[model samples]
Target: MSKGQQWDVVSGVGITALAVAAARAVETGRPDALIEDPYARGFVGAARAPVKLPTTPAEAEAADGRGYWAQVSTYIAVRTRAFDDYFRQAAEAGVTQAVLLASGLDTRAFRLPWPERTVVYEIDQPLVLDFKLTVLREHGATAGGVHRPVGADLREDWPAALEAAGFDRARPTAWLAEGLLPYLPSEAEESLFHEIHRLSAPGSRLAVEAIGNIPGALADTAANGSVRTLGVDLADLIHTGQRPAPADRLTNLGWNVRTVPATETAAEHGRPLSPAFVERDARYVFADRPPRAIASSAMSSVIRPPV
Candidate 1:
């Protein structure tokens, strides 16, 4: 489905963002959590619709099912930690500019201990970003870096919006597209990377969490009954089937790419492993645009997905 002209906290793909916030809030409450997002709980609290956070395996099962939701929670927790490390490494390497594409409820701009001179630009639907900012403001949350929010649809001219919001394309940037691509059609996904390749300066780092083909459990409407109880369908939100390979695109764009299995990341963090992790084509990919000269040109646009 194409993105609508507008969306709120509980409609379309926006609702999935709330679910992700819920997962993050629950994870932050964990004693052995890989990352702590203090704003996550507040975001959930401020949501227009009730968000059922999975603070424990029991809560997860109650929200979805005995096994599937538990696995989803573990997967989210693992994904959060891995992406956190990606930003840290980028900062340690002296890349001060960060761009979060389809940022959703991500609070990395406020939570992570960013190096001095770091500037983070978040790009997403206008209302989604507005809701997040409103909650953070109400809770008196402070940012760790220069946080700039660009309210624009990714399907449109978001790069222009980003540039207007003080994103410097000349500097190396740390870019993230987590839990995002599966919603876009294959052609849109490819066009997205093409834009990223054009906008990235050498030494830029990119991280993504994606599934080549959505898992049967998440794609099965009947199986996701527990998720439906909360008024959000995990399966319905996702655009399933084959899609563009981001790694291959980045490689052709002169970036060095590395991919790690989601299960391996979970194992490294000492988290539980489930078939959901090992029995799927899920992966966390990292690609770095090397410190070299880049061609000064804008990429030609391809056909946009059917609107």
Candidate 2:
């Protein structure tokens, strides 16, 4: 795999999932998990990802630095569960529309017990989507029903492509920006939200996994600054670029926000968070519309699931 393809970003999640797999391994002593996802381990092993250490220990360590891969495992588990909860809540609230932005190798549609008429739209790079679909078919995994896979770069004009693929943005939408925004430049991050806000309707809900606090925050020393000072680096294993805005940027954009620390999110999921997972506040936002609007591409376009 090349360094910076959309597929490459998929690796971070893979590592996190594989960490979860390790947890699963510790729990069940099974190579095959109910997530039954052999892919997580296979991908890491095939590419030798875990073995590829960063050049400088500090740079590698300074990065997402999953040196504490075990700790990261807890985070991935929490995030995946949180998003799933958001999806279930949205469904219970009678909102049938859900769009996962930058939806890498996500298999939620296949795993979750979605309500009837629920549609899960996954958008990601063509190559990444292709790899996942091929693997999924080989694993005998089908989305069951009402799943739309739109292959496109989120940085480009994906809204048009999404509409063409049958997304109904005017209705209530449960939107997710998971494992994405931090990869974008600060401006690009803003643009991404503006685009989302543009598309959302009155009852729409939005959730984000944003970097806020970290354990090192309370340290009297300044290694990477404070716990809040360091956020997720865009690159995994390798240090690439930086997206410097704090997690609070979302609030500035006129959306209601909720901040949840790793500890709180862990407790919500009924898990004991490791110390590494603690020491900082991450955000899980819920933003609704003002019951008024300027036109957005999603608002004007009428779409239904391409079941």
Top candidate (lDDT):
1
Model 1 lDDT, residue 117, Cα: 82
**Model 1 error, position 2 (Å):** 3.5
Which window of ten consecutive residues has the lowest lDDT sum in model 2? 225-234
175-255, model 1: which lDDT tens digit per residue?
Answer: 999988877777678888988888898888899876765765464434546355446666766667766678877888889
Clashes of 2: 3
Q: What TM-score would every model get versus the actual structure?
A: 0.88, 0.69
lDDT of all the models against the reference? 0.78, 0.58
Q: In model 1, what is the error at residue 58, expressed in angstroms?
A: 5.5
Candidate 2 matches the true fold with a TM-score of: 0.69
Best-fitting candidate, measured by TM-score?
1
Per-residue CA lDDT of model 2 for 1-307, tens digit only, reads 2324455323543332223333322222223212233344333233334333222224334545444433444556677667777787888888887888877667777767778688888887776667667766777776744889898766678889888989887887888887665455555566778787778877787888765542242231134322222222213322124454434555676666666665777786566566544654555665655555656767557665576
